[model samples]
Target: MAKAFASAGDLTEKKISFTEVGEGLYAFTAEGDPNSGVIIGDDSVMIVEAQATPRLANKVIECVRSVTDKPISHVVLTHYHAVRVLGASAFGANQIIMSDAARSMVMERGQEDWDSEFQRFPRLFEGHESIPGLTYPTTTFSDSMTVFLGSRRVDIKQIGRAHTAGDSVVWVPDQQTMFTGDIVEYHSACYCGDGHYEEWGATLDAVKSYDPQSIAPGRGDALVGREMVDAAIANTRDFVDSTYNAVKPVAARGGSLKDAWDAVREACDPKFADYAIYEHCLPFNVARAYDEARGIAHPRIWTAQLDLDMWEALQG
Candidate 1:
């Protein structure tokens, strides 16, 4: 292969930051790694996006402990990705929630995703053995649901599809803060392997319509003020648009996947070369974009072997 497969060569530990985006609301970020959010209500706390393993989840728990002593009552997963859902067991929350579509995806390809991600990024899966198994949600909602943590009212809604088929966002009406899973990213590559490129813009629009004052994105730093929030959303949109638009033309002309990869690099590398996980996500993003442009609706499930084969083919 021309270079390391995905993030296998990335072994250095990242700097973790727990930033406050709103009153009693925090965003747990690790440089450019996947981020998690904390919503402390009057009587209890609600966690968004569990880390990859129990050990990693402990890091977020420690941050939660520093601010408040409320027991975690519920865990709301924004999506079904292994990196985000596998750590649910550590929270010991009374209820775990996900979108109805996310649960179905878990039943279909959760294990395969776990294996594929474990192989691509060894560092994120530290203490992988501790993961009880595929994380399943105890409850799910179709369109939107409201959970009141004591007096705090939290609104969870599936705005549209961007990062995944069942992507959802958490909104705190009082503070005008929203926790957008992978739908919006800041200074990090959006992993579009299972994304819907055509529908992502509408999803972004749905999120923007709220006029959120603060946002805890799926990856990158926490956006505090309205200026930062708007900037991050715009940046995320550009990243997604550049990737799909670059590949759509190639696929329309019956070009090979390699051709699409080169086109995307030419378009995106100049602007996003320094973005976190850019190289790791490029191949998969290009492959998915090409498939979408060719009329493939659902993303093909990725396995460990398929990951290696795709990397080798793209390198050649």
Candidate 2:
């Protein structure tokens, strides 16, 4: 397993990095952590995903301030993961936008997910006490919604599900750029704990359909150029396929989760040895893949106990 999680004990507090992908589009990324995007318009700015807490979100706000002082009018949630959505309040956006499916996930598992994520990733929740409560969207849509930043247009759509049931992407056609939340990752690991491996490839394909010149993924460095974009999507797809295919046969034979995990580890550790968080995410990834291979359509909710139990069972 790669040593991505080995540095978990050394993680510093949230810090933001702003990379300009276009004239007004900036990709705000943290250190191998959840990312938020900024789109500056003539009169206002729109933030993509909110961080995990107000403290974290404020860092993104600070970066935005460096470029322009436009009021943050809208905060768009790419999905309903607690680490991504709970920080909405810090932005003080007049309108919090999300897909209809995302709103449903918030209502269904928001609290449980919030608890589960906090327990698994303590560092990301720097000031957990500062969080007011669960975040709910003020505006939601089923398929697509368009918001204009004065003359600039930002399109939000629930293209398809991959990482979770409510995964969405922010596409700026004019800039030929896309902000894909967990739908794509570069260098960093793809957290498949709540992912649908079968549909993940298709989701990547959908994102590629836009032919984005640049893409800010959920984590890692922002991708530039069509070649880089395709490579990133392919890397994410291969990661999912390798894990699922490696574990499926073992699962079909009624092998134990441990046995399946071992098989997947041996198969993937060679090819994906350099990817970030490979070790940190392998156990959870294997568990979900094993379950899916056995016909479990929906990913089982992860709790703290489940996390520790799986870690010990597979990594012990």
lDDT of 1 by residue, 1-316 (tens): 4889999999999999999999989999999998999999999999999989998999999999999999998999999999999999999999999999999999989999999999987999999889999999999999999999988999999999999998999999999999999999999999999999999999999999999999999999999999999999999999999999999999989999999999999999999999999999999999999999999999999999999999898853
Give candidate 2's error at residue 253 in angstroms: 1.7
Tell me each candidate's TM-score: 0.99, 0.95
lDDT of 2 by residue, 101-135 (tens): 88988888788888888876778887889899999
> What C-alpha lDDT, on a 0 to 100 scale, does residue 266 get in candidate 1?
97
Candidate whose TM-score is highest = 1
Measured on C-alpha atoms, candidate 1 has an lDDT of 0.95
Candidate 1: worst 10 consecutive residues by lDDT? 307-316
Candidate 1 local lDDT, residue 308? 95
